[model samples]
Target: MRNIYFVRHSIQDLSVQDDASAPLTKAGNVLAKELTRLFINKSITAIYSSPYARAFQTVLPTAEKLDLIIDTHADLRERQAIWRLDWQEHLANLWQDFELKADGEESFADVERRIVPAFQQIYDDTEGDIIITGHGTALSVLFHHLTHGQFTFSDWQNMNMPDVYIGHFSDENVLVGLEKIAR
Candidate 1:
């Protein structure tokens, strides 16, 4: 059995102008340390994160502790352009219709197209337990893809900042178990 851990980035400072540049908040920093503690004993073989600053910050403590370099993937970023002007409306629109995309924004299918392949590549290439720090929407899509759309928007809504999603995979690329842990 191989396990992949997907951790949503910790709380972020919402005051930043650029969402991609937003760093973790003080509480988020503390949570990062706690995240390190949670995984220190898990024998994580590799660590990966979104290119976003918040996600990178969330994984830093653990990566440092484990002496593993954190690899980044652009597709792991949150649903793009949702953080742009009238982002709340954009987010609502996204949930209402996964196909909706504003200029420069990504539809759910677009996100899935990029994210799922990266996730699959990681699953196929990696050995032993792995950790990937990502955003809410992208991670949700990945879970939905892995479970053949068994996961839903409600599951995405229920996800917490810094939540831990554990996926257990068989040798045949079948998902045996999917568990979510809130922190």
Candidate 2:
């Protein structure tokens, strides 16, 4: 069985205006280290992460233990927007219409266009258990697609920083099981 783990980046330093440059919070670093416990003995073969700093930081601990180089991909980055702590309504609005693009923002469709294919490429070529580190919006969007739209915005809203979601692919091109890795 092949297992894909989508690991959401931990708490990021919001003071940094640049999303790609933003690093994880000190506490988030501690939390990120704790993530290694979840993957032990899981037979993780490859680690893939968003090029963004925070995303890369989140998976670093696991990569270190496995002695694997994290493969970064641009499409795994978050949705293009200046998201705020109180922007739940804004996110909800975006989810309501997949094609709706806000001023200075990429629509859900645009994000979907890039991330889905990137994910497919990873899924098709990769072997064994894999870890994909990414941001909330982007990973949620991917999860929504994989779950046939069952993973809704509400699911995204409740997501924890440094979240882990496991998907089991028992057969090629099909997801046989899915679940959140609750601590």
Candidate with top TM-score is 2
TM-score (all chains, Cα) for each model: 0.91, 0.96
What is candidate 2's lDDT per residue for 120-159, written digit by digit as tens? 9998878988999999999888888888899899999889
Per-model lDDT:
0.87, 0.90
Per-candidate Cα RMSD to the true structure, in Å, reads 1.9, 1.4
Instruction: Tell me the tens digit of each residue's lDDT in model 1 across 92-178.
Output: 667667788978878988888999888888777789999999999889888888888788778888888888989998988889989
**Model 1 accuracy (lDDT, Cα):** 0.87
Q: List the residue pairs that clash in candidate 2.
A: none
TM-score of 2: 0.96
